[model samples]
Target: MPLRALFGLLLCAGCAPLSAQDATRAPEPNTRVPAGVVRYAPSVFPDRIVLSPAQDAAHGFAVAWRTDATVAAPVLEIVTAGDSPDMGTPRQVRASSRELRTENGIARHHRADVDGLLADTLYAWRVQGGGTWSAWHHARTAPAPGAPLALLYFGDTQNKNVSLTTRVVREAMRHAPDARLALFAGDLVSGGDGEDDNEWGEWFEANESLPTSMAVAPAPGNHEYFEEFEDTPRERRVLGAHWPLQFALPGNGAPGAERTSYWFDYQDVRVAVIDGTSALDLGTAQAQARWLDGVLAASPHRWNIVVTHQPFYSPRAGRDNALLRKHLLPVIRRHAVDLVLQGHDHVYGRRLPGEAPTPVFVVSVAGAKQYRLSEQAQRTMRPVAEDTQLFQVVRIDGAHLRYEARTATGRLYDAFELRDDGSAKSLVDLPEGRIDERRCERAKTLKGRADRCWE
Candidate 1:
């Protein structure tokens, strides 16, 4: 297929406008129908079954979901089995509901918090919505600081996002099944009906199998915002109801973020997630910034990695990530961050630890969407994928962390290893393959609208 069509195809494919629903009624976009495909609704849609972990990670995890109409209180429960098939059915715990009202309409958000969980242990859980419970999801508590850990990171899958992004993630999982954490550098979804409930469902469904295995650490991207919602940008759009509830994160709230923003110590890793979208565009930047410094300063983990949506520097050459540089750079450099992960440019860019205050900043993209790399990114650039669909598997062992970029079809595009010998150091590079040897690298512009492709 032509590159232009490919670009459009890869960009995010989500809930289209709610086909002129009644202006005076309906809690959500009144769907002529719910679930499955239709000739009229030619595009694929998602179901509202997002299961995440919330609350104190050591003792409790929460589950959340949305329904067309008000649903009865759900029963959140769990069970135990050390990877045994006979782990018996998970038991039920607690359930509650929150009314989510939007211009589109209002719907009930169900939440179930499973309490009395074992520290640093694995268990299975599910929730009962209308008498039927969700499938058993397995998870473990966050490791206290000083524990060894691993996580997966992906860039923006916002525009032209397709099933290819799905395979990239699935392939990454196949590469590292034991990864305890999943890190998204933002741009989870594209900029459009940012308030659409099932839009997030598509994102969650993509990672459902993995959530059953580990907790996810998320950062909001600009696209996560909704300018059409009101005069102001509707960043995050209550994604928390799903984020906090499904991930069952730590309540050690970030210095200023309270529950909406927090930090948690997982093993020897103190993963500090910052909501750049909320802080920068939605009116919480200063507070979150102050808390970020405190979290980094207090982080006693052997490896310190900050995950956010926007990058302090863009390897996209002519591109600039000035806003974040002014806001977050100093803090990161001062604390000596090992790696920075971000997505927005719809391409892959990595920076070395030299001139930059931090060791390395890597930009990655998951999903089928592709972009041409900047010319500046070619020579000065270390590794860049201007127009490729990719994802990364990050494995952390002892004082060492390794990352590999693989194609959605599961080809090892590039691999790098880092050893912490007092400081971050890179070993020999992995063998260069066909991907690394291609000229389809950088182009003047991406396929669709230049603004959409670049953004």
Candidate 2:
């Protein structure tokens, strides 16, 4: 974890080569296993079942899964849960299936829409892979309009130690069992564009409960993009090979930003996922900017939440996303976005609640990767954490939004409340006992040790 190695790791998404001083540093560990060698085996069972919010969550939901090539026609069996003990017969919905070839092998990806669902009602569903069937899973649709809601937010759970990262996700879920939605602010895997099936598998396995129950909303991060060759740098990169096939997202977004950048409403909150990487690299910034304006202007929800991989107000020095700030921040501010959740800096940071119109900007990390806090971060953000893995839970009720950040060990690290009046809003910092910040002296000593760090 020398300075050179740190720079290489931080700039890996841009495909930057390691410096000469980093040549002797140990290579980052690869966590993929043989079992993750994505291959197709025609079995009756389906895997990777994920549930996502449709444009209209009250009356619709989307499900996506993977099956072997033999499963020519994938199907979903869904039914309303009965009041009594006996379960009723389910109506079958045929799913659209597609073949996706990856470095591991070829597999069939299937997706289906469940429409006309009763609002706030319990429903059971299962997927069919040829003659095989998955276990019945249940999920609840969004409640009546304006009802109170809670959700969990996670930052980058990207690489090397998924086992360690999975625990944090599970712990967050355990702490917020009532949460109806889970938001992943990008970089679900270390080598998404490279088709690292093992890393993808580990990520999927880590959140087994979410896909079956809670609706998942994910944004794409720079690491999610991979170049044609590992050593080629960032000259050529594309969205991860697994993205489109892995999640069924809303299509109402910028023409080219479907699935990756979209907006959906749940109860009183409108959550918008913006494609920061696309804006930064693909020249989709203007399109997304206009779409964002329209989405927010048209939203009737009580709270507006925006999720992106890169922070407009960067928490790390020498990592400012000025382009994003210039193109998207104005729109975010104009719309009075209530909360902006972000990742990619590998640290936890929050700009103290300020004057009117400025949304709560937060950058956090939930994986094992750690980064040092910069002078700019220390000077601007209060209650920032370096070398700490954290998760957030947000609850929305009428005009009030409550946010809490917690460590992997269930310690409360940060908390705040944002209350909206008819015309403007107010911010209140919630006091909590937090662990002492990890400093450079201790961090430098831990470099290349169990916990990677350096100055």
Candidate 3:
């Protein structure tokens, strides 16, 4: 393949335009696609079924789905998958439904919260919507307290979710089949308003069956918030209605930010999901900061991790999250967070803790969107990549945590280990058989456009 075409496929920088904040859409004009080519519409049957972790993943969990507005009464049936030939009797739970109007059409979102489940047990579930039953899917609860756990992390599957990003997610799953939870570091879709049903549909389709088996904890990004009105002189953006409607999240977040900002404990890990978009743009930064400090202060888990959309240290050139750095960074550093997983830079960067009680900060992207690395990133980040699609797998045991990053083709790109010494955590780089940092050569000028490289 030609360099530009290869770059187009590897880094989906060609799909949709970057976020609304970017001055230019796709820098390259030839990568644009027609609207009619992308088709991901809603249907009468239940689709886009996703599983989210409850506050206590071992004892409770939730599942959310979508269907036509006509499905008045949606139901979910779950049964324990035991060693016997026949599956055990199923328990039926009535799901709460809400009607939402979108660009595609009108659809109803149904969410069912299940509690009192046995810890570390596998359960088979199916949902009834549009008078049809979905295929039986399997999900496992978190292991017993202090038990070993594996987690899957992704940066931004924002652009070309179905066409290009699906392989990265699937390959990650194949690499860690036993992962219990997955964390999406915001920008799950490219739609700025976040109400585009086609984009949501494509994101759901891209994940395939991963959400069904492993619990997901997603943080909202700037792209998830859309302006309330396009013609209004003033800009007033609100959280997309589809965001809260599609995924059933824990309501244990701070006031004014319930589902978007919350925390959940899985096994020996406490994952704090923050609403960076709301905090930076919507005047809830201080509230979320207070809430985060409280959450981190009271955490009893062996390992504490924070996941958000914006990064304290951005990897892109001439980009920085001032508000996030001002409000959230101190709280994160004060609490001595173990890991900070962030996105929105469309590049890979990792910073290890030094003499200060700082956490291991990592910014990664799982989609095709690519960006130029900042000069600061070049000097600060030890191992970084550009124009590369990556996924992360983390395993946390009693006192040891293993982290690994791999490309879309399943090549180990970065690895590290952290061991807790009861007083503080120590990091050790695990760089064996890892590939060299990937970068593109600079080109003076392109035909008519100012300097641009082939990703």
Error of 2 at 362 (Å): 0.6
Q: After superposition, how far is residue 15 of candidate 3 from its true place, in Å?
A: 22
**10 residues in a row with least lDDT, candidate 2:** 443-452
Once model 3 is optimally superposed onto the true structure by TM-score, how far is the C-alpha of residue 379 displaced, in angstroms? Answer: 1.3
Residue 299, candidate 2: Cα error in Å is 0.4
Tens-digit lDDT string for candidate 1 (197-301): 444545655664765566666676766555545555552343333344333445655543555566665666666777766665555666676777888898766
Candidate 2 clash figure, as a count: 1
Cα error, residue 213 of model 1, in Å, equals 2.7
Strongest candidate by lDDT: 3
Order the candidates by lDDT, highest first.
Answer: 3, 2, 1
Best by TM-score: 3
Displacement of the residue 244 alpha carbon in candidate 1, Å: 7.4
TM-score list, all predictions: 0.76, 0.88, 0.89
Report lDDT (Cα) of residue 263, candidate 3: 96
Model 3 misplaced regions, further than 4 Å: 1-38, 83-85, 192-195, 230-232, 442-455
The digit string of per-residue lDDT tens for model 2 on 1-455 reads 46755654453333333445445555445464544444433344688889999988888889999877778777899988776656887989899888876655667889998898889988989889877789888899999777889899999988754567778988898899999999999987778435466677677777767779889999999887776565655566688767888898888878667757999989988899999988987888888998999999999887889999999888776787888888888999899898999999888899866566459899999887777677788988888987788899999888888999999988898888888887778888888676666443232212343123321
